[model samples]
Target: MPNFNNLQYASEPGSPTSPSEDWAQATADLIVVLDGATARTETGCSHGISWYAEHLGKSLLLAAADTTLSLVGVAKSAISRVACLHPECDLTHPGTPSAGIAMLRPDGRYFVLGDVAIVAESTDGIAVIVDERVSQTGVAERAEVDHYLIGTPEKAAALLPMKRAELAARNIPGGYWIAAADPAAADHALVGHLGLDDGAPVAVLTDGAARAEVFGLLDWAGLLDLAVAAGPLELIQRVRAAENSDPLGAKWPRNKASDDATMVTASVAS
Candidate 1:
């Protein structure tokens, strides 16, 4: 069985009331990391983004525990299960809470939905898989959100319109898929299996944890090395420090100064 080494995680809300919408679950044989979508518009459900994300994450953990179901099958079922919890709300509402997901199965297969990052290391090298469809689909909206940079009054003013557009794009044609009420979105997830010889040193990350490489702070190899040497929480702190150095995103523009960061790493047994 693979073991989680340097098993650590850190999650800070983008804002105090926002609630950290990221979650993770791990067993000797399974690992999952999820980043819940922030509500761009008002959701009819009083429970809000945090509520939906928690239910969805818990449901996913339960469904994936089955082990026998195909990954996609379980993922879709989980979406449907979460949706059933709120029959009173407009499930099709663009502001509905959702999440990006990454899962590692005992069979050496890994799956991804939305922009979650999954990296596996072996003698060959490092392989990172991310689904960019979400980012791509909301390009214009993202630009609008980024226009004034996070933390700026102007950006705050534009947030509602920008997020409305962002929310509108979900699950539509040319829009990206996510773990929302619609399970069919699971069909677009990224999936792959590791080779038997693909050794240990696997790292699964939320986008925040991946900023080191994504922002050119470290290469993939260095990321794996750092996780082993410093522990996963340290890696997140490093990101926090980096973001603090440019809180308004002057040097490195971004949607927010810091996002909820989370990671889980596992090493192959010898």
Candidate 2:
């Protein structure tokens, strides 16, 4: 049977005072990571982003344990399960709690939605999978926000229009899909199987942990090497250090100086 060994996992919140909107969990046959979308405007749900991520992550893990279900089916079941948890909320609201998802099954099947990523090494080569549709949506608004330092009033003001645009573009035919109230979003996930070599490296990351690649600090192979040598937490620390070096958006411009980061690393075995 396929299994994972030498697993290393870590998570850190963007702000020390706030609960992390990212969540990760690993079972004998599955690895799941979720990055909750921060609600810049009002979300119709009272349970909030963190709650949505945790419930979705847990539900996905449970559903994936069945092994017989396809990854898309797992995602559909999980989203539907979470939606049932808050029947009183306005699930139809555009800003309803949602998250990016990345999941790996023991047989080398991988599923990705939104910005979360899955990087795996196999006999064929290295494969990195992530959905970049959201990044393509808010170009002008995102550029404006990146001009100012994170946490500044200017940046906050700029984020409002960007977030509004994002909500407007979300889950439409031309827009991106995420784990939310609608189970149909699961059908939009990127899915495939990798012939992962025995003892090959694998990493699943939320976008925050993946910012290193976005910033050109490290390539996917290098990041996996770091995780193997130092540990997964070191990857988070490296990202934090990089973010600290560019606090004012002078070097690397972005909407936030820091974001909730989560990573899971392991070696494939059978």
lDDT of each: 0.77, 0.90
Q: Using Cα atoms with residue i matched to residue i, what is each candidate's TM-score against the true structure? A: 0.91, 0.98
- Candidate 1: count the clashes: 0
Model 2: residues with Cα > 4 Å off, grouped in runs? none
Best candidate, lDDT-wise? 2
Candidate 2: tens digits of C-alpha lDDT, residues 1-270 = 889988899999988999999999987688999999989998989999999999999999888878789999999999999999999999999899999999997679989989999988876888898899999888899888888887799998999999999988898899899989999998988999988877888999998999879888899999888987788899999999999888877788888779899999999888
lDDT score of residue 3 within candidate 1 = 43
* Candidate 1, superposed: residue stretches over 4 Å from native: 1-6, 196-199
Candidate 1 lDDT score at position 187: 89
Per-candidate clash tally: 0, 0
lDDT of candidate 2 at residue 202, scale 0 to 100? 93
